[model samples]
Target: MVNVFEQEDIMNTLKHMHKWFNDGLINPDAATTDQGPKWCVVSSGQGFPGAEVSWATGRGKDVYAEPFAGPLYSTTSILGSVNAISASSKYKTEALKYLEFVNTDETMRNMFAYGIEGTDFSKNEDGTITRTENCYSPATYSQATYFTLYPVAPNAADQWDKVEEWNETAESSVLLGFNFDRTNVETEIANCSLIMSRYDKELYTGTRDPEEAVPALYEELEKAGLETIREEYQKQIDEWLASK
Candidate 1:
């Protein structure tokens, strides 16, 4: 696959991005909104509905589904944002019991998922959930287990069964189990991060012309030892692949 920032590719990509902006196909002012490409890069339980509803609400005139261009890859490693109970908790036994309760108890799970159902939401005759008027979900992630959370949208309820199928069928990453220890490259990593932070927003959001920014970004990353970081990461990846 051609890197998006490569000299040949960057100019063309930026040209299209600029045209999209000029033609109102892209909204830079609302770049952080749920409808933004950045937020909807991949379908998510939360973002997908918001993006769909944007179309229903007359906000997604230019929005259309596009097929992903490249091969799909899922890391062998599991990904999550929630924290488990700490080992040192004073209520360790209680925490363990709570974990067991949430995992096994349907009523508790429903309560956590729906949030006092009559107030926050109500079940339709078809068994799908509809949010009550003037009510919002209380911390979507904190509700039930993520997987057990009831779908709020009609379409979502229909597609819920495919979530596991999609996850299981994704192509596994080549660098699956390896987590890079960047201690030796800490300085390089920090400098590269800083460089990306300075230029990434403008470049990624198409707020600035790539003709001027790309070379400068590359120059800064080079000075910041991006090559060294790449070499180190490649070494780890190669070793990981060999092991597998």
Candidate 2:
């Protein structure tokens, strides 16, 4: 990923952002806005195709979500949600058993995901679930394998099947399992992060001109040891690939 931040494609994207911001196509206060859920006519976020339903419900407005690109499986995405038992916990065995039950037992998994059956949610004759007004809603994927839970209303009963298919067919990134060991370059990483914190928000929010800001940012990053961090990442990736 050496020089990736200053690549031509990245610069072009920033330039497009600058044009949009200048033309009043983007929120002017985006760089400093603290208000949450400031509704806009359009927005982008990481989500599945059917996620628009939930988003629209939350914002009280009709919304449409279309994927800009195909899904690519990567280490970062896989690690987004995980449950880990504490090494120092005395209930490690019990925790493991609970996790196993949640993943393998359909009833337990569905209970955690959708709340009590016949109360918070009821299984429909068509195999979908009708959720009632309740405070027991949980992020389904984070709880257990999605296949174990019934689909909520408006989602197809075969939703999990489609999700499984998507996962099976998704292209895997070259860096799928390449976790960088930052031990050697911890200082460099810290310094580079500090430099990035200074300019990234303004540059990405289009508050600054990429033509001028990109070079200035890169200069500061280099001075802060970005090159050292890049070299270390490359070194680790090379070793990882060779091992594979």
Candidate No. with top lDDT: 2
For candidate 2, write residues 1-244 as lDDT tens digits.
Answer: 6596658888888898899899998779878777754687777788764677768877888988888765888888888756789999999999999989999998888888888887888888878988898548876766767777787777777777777777787898989977888899999888888888888878887888988988888898889888888888888888999999
Tens-place lDDT per residue, model 1, 1-244, is 1234776765887766766666766567643445545344323232322245444334434455444432335342244434478877899889878888886786677677667788888877765677766675466555335455555654456444555455455565655456787987999999989988887767666676777888898888889998898888878777777878
TM-score, candidate 2, is: 0.88
Worst 10 residues of 1 by lDDT: 41-50
lDDT scores in order: 0.64, 0.82
Candidate 1 regions off by >4 Å? 1-4, 7-12, 21-64, 67-77, 81-83, 134-136, 143-147, 242-244
- Candidate 2 lDDT score at position 36: 50
The TM-score of candidate 1 is 0.70
lDDT of 2: 0.82
Q: Estimated TM-score per prediction?
A: 0.70, 0.88
Model 2 misplaced regions, further than 4 Å:
81-94
